[model samples]
Target chain A: MNAEDRADHFIGRLDAAAAAVEQKLDALLAPSTLKGEIERPARLLEAIRYATLGGGKRLRPFLVIESAALFGLSGEGPLRAGCALEMVHCYSLVHDDLPAMDDDDLRRGRPTAHKAFDEATAILAGDALLTYAFDVLADPATHPDAAVRANLVLALARAAGLGGMVGGQALDLAAESAQKPLNQQEILTLQAMKTGALLRFAVDAGAILGAADQRQAATLTRYGAALGAAFQVADDILDAEGDAAALGKRAGKDAERGKATLVGLLGLEAAKARRDALVEEAIAALEETGLGDATATLAEAARFVALRNS
Target chain B: MNAEDRADHFIGRLDAAAAAVEQKLDALLAPSTLKGEIERPARLLEAIRYATLGGGKRLRPFLVIESAALFGLSGEGPLRAGCALEMVHCYSLVHDDLPAMDDDDLRRGRPTAHKAFDEATAILAGDALLTYAFDVLADPATHPDAAVRANLVLALARAAGLGGMVGGQALDLAAESAQKPLNQQEILTLQAMKTGALLRFAVDAGAILGAADQRQAATLTRYGAALGAAFQVADDILDAEGDAAALGKRAGKDAERGKATLVGLLGLEAAKARRDALVEEAIAALEETGLGDATATLAEAARFVALRNS
Candidate 1:
């Protein structure tokens, strides 16, 4: 199929995967009237539901489902795992938009968690979503094999923990007080940790679910890394040129916040070139996995990450 | 031994366990230079270390260690598992003391996390600690059996997650704006979810580590529930009578904040009575376990929960 056709096909699959994940999330977090309750508090649940369901690209889940399908393993395991990843992703957004963090009032064209609920409820919602992610992964229903569940938990913990997303956030906070701008390498390191880490986990998680060998996992991991970089570069590009209305978040805020970006360092054309190169690298790594034509949609996903306007 | 002597013995053991856990936390969280870094960021690490490491009674860890000792399965597993629980406990405190939450400046006789570090760092540190807890629990080093690690992860997630600690916090927040003071039953359910959940998990985790049969697990769970209730009731007693110098936190704040507590529902004398009854109930549950002398320390712990000052 042509590139445009392939991208359309990937978008269709992404929509389907996102819908499935939303269903899983709803069932997992449905409002409950437990025994002996005059009323169950609904604010936290509302905040969590607002922060999650019915928005965003669901790209990470798509990566997970597609990557798992490469090994002919497509079922509850990958879908639930993907939902867990999405939960983490959603939780990060909730916390990141807090008044003390990014102070974002809008997310996905709606009021952010702290805006929709309150600061305390938003914090609790983020904490709840994060904690719930692990519970979902560790449940026997996610995968009957305890070992696989354990591996997923470990991998996710590492990706989301001190040396990964949280640590990166610390660095980002430190940058505000930094005496000097971060150099190119520092920017790359920061972005890799802040954003790339979870995306990498998205694809790598599929390998774990499919029980891929070390070499196979490594190949997919490289693809994930490259795709992650491409996605970030595209994000930078979008931040520079996209409209806030379309992006569903404030655009150009990164530059306004004095945050470092590759696009700022390399200029628009160079950043675009870098994105395309990374997408090529991602496709090449997928080819190395020997999944052949099965990787077409995944390949298109990498291309879409580099080229998407919003 | 006499009851006083038995309580003293448990205290001594708790001191030793706390020391061991301190060492483990130090090693796990020591600031490190990752790949391609001249210096690691210190603020986040410092906040996490400060929030944990040196304060509190280590009561949950004590529970895990003492409860695991019943089966003579004292090893890295229980210690690490206990530390994981402690991390979750610590993270909860860090977030709970945020300006948006309880707004306490003091915790364990020092400045709270948000007070010591800025709000963003405190939030990230808590997130890091929470994320790190799962990493510790899921590691092979925690338990050779992946199934055991997975179970630990699952249990910790449940206790600390949406339906547990975070959910409880949300309920507590709603109570402030609540038109009516929480009734006795509402207060009981809130306290059970907020404080009792993790404490219950602490003891239940020991059963999992011990590979207890269903009957044995249920007995221990009952013990945990009673012990958890006793601890919260005793905490209410302390809040009413204990000085800040002794409690290491503001005393009488619950009443000042219009927060619901068992002490508020029942008068001081009745709250004390309830504590004693729960401790006795805890001891009875332990007796039913048929572990005999192995439960001596556990029984003493229940009394300590009821009677300890600060």
Candidate 2:
């Protein structure tokens, strides 16, 4: 298929995979009422559902399924892994929007979880969703391989915890009061940890579930890491130059907060060039994996990240 | 042996188990230096260590190891499970002391995590610990059975997340505004979800690891549930009547916040009586488990929960 046609095909598959995951997520999150002694509290569940089920690109879940498909593993494990990645992403977003953090009232063109619910509820919801991610992986009905499931759980935890997303957040917090602006390397490191870790995890989870050989897994990890960096660079550009309506979040807010960004460290043009180089590197890394369809779709997706205004 | 002698023996075993688990936790949480690109953020790890170690009674870990002993399953899995439970417990304590929540300054006779670190750092530390709990359980190095490990993960997640501890916190938040005092049943239900869920999970995890029969698991679960309630009742009494120095936290703080406690709802005498009854029930349930030594130690430990000052 032509590049455009291929992109369309993958997007369709991504959408379908995301829909299936949404259904599973809903069922997984439904409160158990088997024992009537304890009534399941609806408010916390409601808050979690509101935060997670709200509209977004579902990019992490898409990456999981796409990467799995590349590895020829389209089984229940990969799908559940996809859903777990999305849950982690959603949890991060919810907490990031809390009054104590980014404090954004709007996300994905709707009220943020903390704004829609109270701050306390939002915090609990994020905690619930995060814990629920592990629960999804642990469910015997879904992920059968305990070793693989445990690996996925570990990957998610490391990516989302102190050494990954939380570390990025800490750096961001520290940078807020810095006398000098963060350099390019610092910004890149922060973004890699903050945003790139989970993205890499999404791809790695798929490869692990697909039982890819160590070499194949390494290639895919490299591909994911590069793609994640490219995606973050694109995000920095979008935050600086894109319209708020298109982004579905407040544009230029990063600059307003003096948060470190690739676009701030490098000029917008340099950032764009860097994004292109990273995307090219990502595609080249994928070539080693010998997965023609995933390589093509992932390459197109990388290009799309560079070009997209939002 | 007399009850006192039996209690001493049980405490010794529990302390040894906790010490072993503590060493493992220290090793697991130690900072690893990433070469070249990624710098390990020492502060975040420091906060995590501060929050996790040198605090609390290690009661949850005691439950895990004690229950594991019931099924004659020893070694890494049980020790790891013990560490995981302690992580969850520590995370809860860290978050519970936040200014937006319990607003306490002291925990285990030390400044709360938020007080020792910044509020945001404390929040992230709790988040990190909670996520790390799943990581420990899911670690392939420790757990041989993926399915069983998954079960443990699910149990911990449900107990620590919204359906359990977080749910209980929400109820406590709402109860703060309630004009009427909570009844005995309400208090028990709240405590069950808040405190009992993890306690039950600890016992159940041991049963799962030991490959206990369904009957034994159920009996152990019952024992844990009653023990959890008794433990909470004892906490209430300590909050009401114990010395701050003895309790290792501010005494009577629960009453000061106008939060309902077993001691507040029932008078001190009635609360003490209920604690005794619950402890007796816990011991009776353990008698049904048919594991002689572990059950005996557990039964004595149940009584110690009511008798110990800290």
Best by lDDT: 1
| Candidate 2 per-residue C-alpha lDDT over A144-175 given as tens digits, one digit per residue, 9 for 90 to 100 | 66677777877888788777887888778778
TM-score list, all predictions: 0.98, 0.95
TM-score for chain B considered on its own, for each of the candidates: 0.97, 0.96
lDDT by residue (tens digit), candidate 2, B1-310: 9867888888897788778877878887877622225775667778999988765567787788888888778888888888998998888888778877778898888889889888777877888888888878887755677777777888898788776888888878778877987887888888998888888898998898888999999999999999889989998998888898988887888899899798888799999999999999998898887776657878877988877797
lDDT of 1 by residue, B14-41 (tens): 8999899888877877764222233445
DockQ scores of the candidates:
0.64, 0.59
Q: Residue B140 CA error for candidate 1 (Å)?
A: 0.5
Query: Candidate 2: deviation at residue B119, Å?
Result: 1.5
| CAPRI verdict (incorrect, acceptable, medium, high) for model 1 | medium
